[model samples]
Target: MQQHRCGGGALAFCALTVAGVMAVTAGCSGGSGAGDASGRGERLRAEAAGAGGSAETLRRAADVLAAAGSAEMRTSMETSAGGTRVTIRGRGAYDFRRQLGRVTVVLPKDAAGEEGHRPITELLAPGALYMKNRGAGVPDEKWVRVDTTALEDGNLVTGGVTDPMAAAELLRSARDVTYVGETELAGVTVHHYRGTAHLGRAAGGASARSRGALAAAAKGFSADAVPFDAYLDEDGRLRKVRHRFSFASDGPAVEVVSTMLLYGFGVPVAVRLPAGGDIYTGLIQQGRTGEGGR
Candidate 1:
């Protein structure tokens, strides 16, 4: 079994917002024309035949991700509700082949220049999950056993870039790769492609059924086809992907989207936690700090 890369703080944050959007769109479109949901399969076939890049370009991008052994990344997250603003900064490393990942985050504070001073670490290793507080004396650790079989069930969603291989697998599984059009992303021109995967309605339906009584009562589970859209650079590297998921009871809706950035081909970064009196661990889950620990 090939290990996937774990996405650390920054990647995870981007994944939740950007990646979530991509997933939703991909599943919704299902390789059909932008608005016409019925002709997805045929539309994808036509698009693949007219793809702008050769097969070699796609292969090279796959190779880059496969060869990526490690990398260092930084991510910032901000959420707003009412009038208050909450922000966080995170840095971490990802081991692509080992399906392991680790990251340290600095909690937010109102004071300027206080962003990188406090640290919390999260690690996903084989057979166990670990979290530590690096700013205090003698770091603390938490662990969970690794279970490989769960990967097959599709229930296991790795936290960070440790699962890039899985992204590669999903790409490989995509069919009807077509050259849809071009768009500007972060000032760079990118070619867009759409693809479809059958993902048998039975499996999709079964998953919906497993959602239990709440889903059954509220939505009335139903099986449906999924779609995906991918954006690639001139070098054929996949920079973004969107997937679409269905909800049984509600009107046809879009679910999750995913975007990938600053992918360092197989190089890892070194990061150390900060040392200070106000630092703490599990800040995200623990909420606002009361001070004292150093």
Candidate 2:
């Protein structure tokens, strides 16, 4: 997430967790660059009595995604309401062995026009989050190094929202899952599955401390199942994922939806930890906020 800020509040926009990072990472540009519902797919369950959808198949698919180790991911999303729409695109690569990864999120070329195209880059290494300068009083040239467990702006904390373990957490927790069939995604034959996860409930069930920001996002989510779609390749690895849901009226009226693509399993990804020079010191407050480069 490039320029707005970092903290629990901005986790939805910047953190590299699942959806947090599966989509690693959105400037949460939050759809400023997204447009039209054309690319925004219709509800998966709304389509048909899925020919290939089954619980066992979905479970195996989840296993494959979790076991993929290191892979490349591409994510896109659109949020729409009141005749307005916001779209986002992001991509990331990770070397799970070293627990290292990087994600970049940007808007459509045309939508970014003269706004200077806000770009958010996040590096997930061992100790901290390497963030880009978001014009938040910090040096705008180098990345800001913030400890993963540190508190931001007195009360806001980064929490586990950016934790890399989130990837496996996503696969293992999905419920009411069903397989939707197979199709070519980015030219590769893939299998699709749909399900929902109550992130709020899950957050509370375990020690998944999201603090205020996460709690708030979870509150806006309803008990109703949020639609989800997953795509798996022949090797049973995850190739794509999509999540669709609507936030509460007090929140953004737009339906919140995100799509993710995965690939390059087992490849090595180089992640460099930022040193003291990379740390931002003055006024530390700033907020900011990809797609598949797979």
Candidate 3:
């Protein structure tokens, strides 16, 4: 492993990108799209306002998203380690029904203030993650496929950005949740809720395609309890959510704060998986900090 590497295998693409430029971002929407039910929506809001409904409301976040069909999202992942902080941001859209999406992630500029790092395009799908513009030894035109289940963080932190749908699915494990009143986000009214989620428990109730990844995350993170804050719209759709995760590193543990903002409900999201030949199959080289070639 390289000194600047955050982890091993395909998972290292995240940190390697960071090492290259000292770098460097999903889910849910509401309306009468796919899963929207006025009756169910009323009950959902009523129940959420009732006693002990916070957790239950959160657990159904994925369902709310699925109902919305698709959404446009912006993500920010900030990792703090050894007094150094890096924030990676991304923007894209997700299709809840197909469990697919694409994000263009931009890394931070190096300390030397060189040109910005090339943005990485990531295709998120069931059980797999395909990344292009992944530096190191890979060619610009080739993509790298990573088995989400094989990643220690279950492609959660490993991919630099959490899968949008996966992030919503993780809410299925919400526990000790409390409604934190209403707030305005992006000019829309939303209800805020806070709680801790257990990845192992989440995997049990997650969508079949997400189970393996969440299960892997359960065993990968330094702890099982992930503190989070979620915001829901009038129809019980998830508008925003933030999760805090800690992972062990060579030195002190790195604290990652991931935030996802969803908007443009019922948006069209089309993501096509790359062909096998377009994927690079050779050993991937690790990048060093302060190095060029992002």
Over 200-254, each residue of candidate 3 has an lDDT whose tens digit, in order, gives: 8998999998999889988878889999999887778888889988776666467
Ten residues in sequence with the least summed lDDT for candidate 1: 21-30
TM-score of 3: 0.86
Q: Write the per-residue lDDT of candidate 2 for residues 201-222, one digit (tens) a residue.
A: 4344322332332234354444
Among all candidates shown, the one with the greatest lDDT: 3
Q: Which rank order by lDDT, best down to worst?
A: 3, 2, 1
Say which prediction, candidate 1 or candidate 2, comes out ahead on lDDT: 2
- Give the Å shift of residue 204 in candidate 1: 18
Q: Candidate 1: deviation at residue 255, Å?
A: 4.7
> Where is model 3 more than 4 Å wrong at Cα?
1-11, 14-45, 111-114, 290-294
Candidate of highest TM-score: 3
lDDT for predicted candidate 2 compared with the true structure: 0.47
Question: Candidate 3, which ten residues in sequence have the lowest lDDT sum?
Answer: 17-26
